[model samples]
Target: MAIDITLIHWIYISFILAVIGFMLFRRDTTIVCVVGILTLAATSTLSVSASITSLFNSFIFAITELLPTILVISIIVAMSKILTKSGINEVMVAPFSKIIKTPTTAFWTIGLLMMVISFFFWPSPAVALIGAVLLPVALRAGLPALGIAVAMNLFGHGIALSGDYIIQAAPKITADAAGIPVLDVVNASIPLVITMGLVTTITAYIILMRDLKKNKTYTSTSTCSSSPIEETQEGLMSERMKKILAISIPIIFVLDVVVMFTLNLQGGDATALIGGTALLILVVTTCFAHKKRGLEETTGYLIEGFQFGFKVFGPVIPIAAFFYLGDAGFYSIVGDYLPENSEGIVNDLGVALANGVPLTKEVGVITLTGVGVITGLDGSGFSGISLAGSIAQLFSTAIGASTATLTALGQVTAIWVGGGTLVPWALIPAAAICGVDPFELARKNLLPVSIGLVITTIVAMFLV
Candidate 1:
């Protein structure tokens, strides 16, 4: 049967054009989002006028669906920012310096801290924490700023985000696409996660060690926030807030981990647990921050947090809407009840690829990993994850590869590339904070991360 362009196809095509145009022109992300919204609205209504109206409606819907996650992330960021302003961030990390006395130790400590913190609070907040508190210590300990940045990038954004054991957001997306239980995806993903973690960490250590051997003990006096340790300060929060954060955050996360294991909860359940905890914390902390003007200050902080979240994630909305058009779950929202056989973009793409591509589990893993790396060129780690999940569905049948494994591999590759290691633009934040050339930081990461990814892919193939 000859496939004809339907309203859905036209909408999808418009989204594609917007994406391509955004990429080529490097346009403001808001512009890209508007374009995508307009395209989807126009197609679903089958009229330009309706499309314009739908554009407004789609934004409203997208914002609504995204509100919870956005609020959760915003609150976390706001709390961290508040902690920094109050000096608890410095105090929180200060204790570690006692045990971490050497450059090597600084590297490992930064990497380890990033992994643990990111596993709970997530990479964006983790980055802020590391950059604020640990960067100075790593620098003084004789670890180069670039090295510290690489370690943070690899452990936090790459490894932690890929595994996402606690947050579970990544797995949830892939699990839905696979039409499988989230627990099934979670169970299947463990081996791949371990494999990638081991390979990436080991490769990173070796590279750092090699660099150390070539030069004698070298220490830096220049101060940068990207290093991992900072001078301790006081008066940020009441000693009470400090104590609460010190005791509360870890306890909540640990309890969450235990509950997940005990109940065998996975994916969205896990994400909900973490996000819910964050919400609770946000409320408590905001309340604490302003006991006098309780509602006003709390609202202000929340607004500030949401503003940051939108700024950070806004461009992503349109991109996600475009990609969501592919998944059946999201198609109804974007497509106006388009039939399965009619013109679903994601389904059509997956079906076509499944038919045309010769894929095995091993090939699928590598292909998705490569796709991740390619997408990472755009310099936002999570940006490629949705597309990666969609593509992973294509190979699941031929390769018998679980969607989780494929998604993990994609997450692993994309994060390393875009999370501030290989991509200069993404590395800029770390570089600027650490006072190093962004390109140099990127080049420094290329070898270690690439090697790690290759090894991790092989490991994922066998394990998955």
Candidate 2:
């Protein structure tokens, strides 16, 4: 049966292409999304007033749906700030510095520790924590600053943030868009994440080793002697308090994880546990560090946390609103205001594709991968994931592929690209900390990340 493609479907497709074009040109997508909302509304409703109202509602709905994730990421980032102020973040990774006696050990140790810390605290904070305490050690162990940057970028942002297993923020966003359970995305991502992580990190390590051999300037005696650990002022906390909080924080998070597994908490339940614990830790640590000013300090920290959270989400909300309209649930929110029996533009398009398009699994995987990569070019990594999820949901139904596997593939690719490994601007934190150019760091990351992405994509074929 041939499915009829409506005007709305073509409009949606056009907007998608416009978004990609905007991203490619390195332009802001917020305006494009805003325009898309207007166009979608105008096409779906005859009344101009109704179209405007529907547009506003879509933004509101997207915010309501994604608020929890924003909150979780904000609280976790705030907690990291508290830890940094208390010097606990530095203390947390201090022990690992002792294990870095050689270049090989330094690379693996720094990379693995970065991966672990990034999982819990996020790469933004983890970069500061690892860089302040461990970078010097890795440098002293004969790794170049560029090499250290690669390790942090690949492991922290590329692998940890891409998978985002511990925090579940990335999976939550993708899962919500796909209209599937978050655990489905989380579970499906495991194998693909591992494959990408190993391939990229190992490839990077080999490249670094070959470069080191070529340039004797990176020898242990020469490189180790020059780099010294940079010091920063610790906030108003006693040494004992710092030690206590450092120990307590990790233990608390680990226990949260164990409890999650014990109680079989998967999606929002798991996220709530983590977010709530972070809030508690933030309070406790603030009180201990600023006893006289605890009340005022806590408020300040909360404000700062919320500020950072909203700042990150500011660009994301409008983009997400445009994509959310593609989902059936969100569409209903706006659809009710439209003409009778108006359907989701994207979902309707999906139905058409499923019936009319000649989509095999191979074609489905490649097209989705390309879409994910293009969406990621916006450099937010996150902005594109919801689109990927929506597209994955559409294509999976069209071709009889595993929705979870497809969604996971899209999630991984979008994140790895925009999450920092492939994008120069996104590579700033890791690059800056190591005193290397962001573009140079991105260049080093290109081969390893490219190889890893290809292998992971191939693995995704089987999963799909």
Candidate 3:
């Protein structure tokens, strides 16, 4: 059966190109996505009223699909805020400061610690966890703030997030779009993720070392001031409570992982376990921190958590909605007035292109990698991951490729780019904390990350 490339498909491709162009100029794609959705609906329905309804339906569909990720992230962030306020976050990483005795040690130690912590709590909160404590230690040991930022960025956002082995948020989105089990994406990403992490981090370390040799006198004192850690006075009772929660939180998450493996839990089951544990920890921590005001404070924490989740997801909604139309399962959300037996625009286009154009394995590899990179231009890292997954499924089906490996390849590329390693704006948290220029940090990361991406892509071709 030959797949016909329709005008609607062309429009979708055009809008995607436009979005990529805007992102290259460092512009937000929210409006472009909105226009794309309206255009898609209008073309498919040929009725203004139907198009308006479709728009709303698309948003609803996106939210429904992504609610789990948003919620888990929100809850974790809220828990981090509580920990920070109660001084447990500082205590958690305080021991790491002792191990940074030299510049080389500081670089690898801080980076490794960030990777481990970020894998569990996420890079955003992990930044907060390590920034104040370990950063000064790294700086004191002769590693420049920019170097520290590179280590943190590469390890936390690039490595931990790209794989997302523990949290599984990235894998969930990609697997759902690929129509595979989350464990498939998770298991498949392990090698690619390791390759990217090692190559990028090592390259970055070499660059930092070269810079350091050029300017031996460039110590932490010359470029930046040591930020003093804040002290919070508390009764012995409260201090003990902090110690207990600090120890308890990490253990609980670790046990959750253990239970997950023991029970053969994956996908929503694993996600539910993590979410439930986070909520429980949040409640316990909130009560311990606010004994007198526990009831009122718990409500406030939940509200804040929900707010943070929605806020972060706000831009992602429209972007995901536009991409969701590329999946056949989501076609109904876009509009029901299309021709009988209508297929997704991207899927149909993939089939048409595959049949009309002879695609070698190399070409398939490059196309998927390019699409992942293009989607990552939005700087959200996550918004385009699902698109990559969906496109991976289409490409794999069209060419008889390894679907899991290709999907993992796309997921890793999208995240490493948008997850904050290559994107300047996305690197703000680490940059701001380390007091380095975000652009400088991004520039420092460019070569290493690019090299890593190329190597990983080639490796992906073999896997597929």
Clashing pairs in 3: none
lDDT of 3 by residue, 230-328 (tens): 234354236677777667777776687678668866545665776677778768877877888878887887787677556545655777777677655
RMSD of 3: 7.4
> How much is the lDDT of residue 311 in candidate 3?
53
Per-model root-mean-square deviation over C-alphas: 8.0, 8.6, 7.4
TM-score of each: 0.58, 0.62, 0.65
lDDT (0-100) at residue 267 of candidate 3? 47
What do the candidate models score in CA lDDT, each in turn? 0.61, 0.73, 0.73
Q: Write the per-residue lDDT of candidate 2 for residues 268-346, one digit (tens) a residue.
A: 5666777788788889888887898988988887887676656545655676677666545345545644324434444
Pick the TM-score winner.
Answer: 3
**How do the residues 1-464 of candidate 1 rate in per-residue lDDT, one tens digit apiece?**
22344566556656655654654443444566567666655556568877666565555655565565455456555555555555565556666678667878987888888889778756655554466456655666778776777778778767787667776876776567555566766676667667766776677777777878897432322122222222344543688677767666656666876776687664345556665666676567656655666577667766766666665445445454444444442444544456545434543443343345467776677677766775565455555666666677667765676666776666667667765566544544445445454445555666677677787788877766
Q: Which 10-residue window of candidate 2 scores lowest in summed lDDT?
A: 219-228
TM-score of 3: 0.65
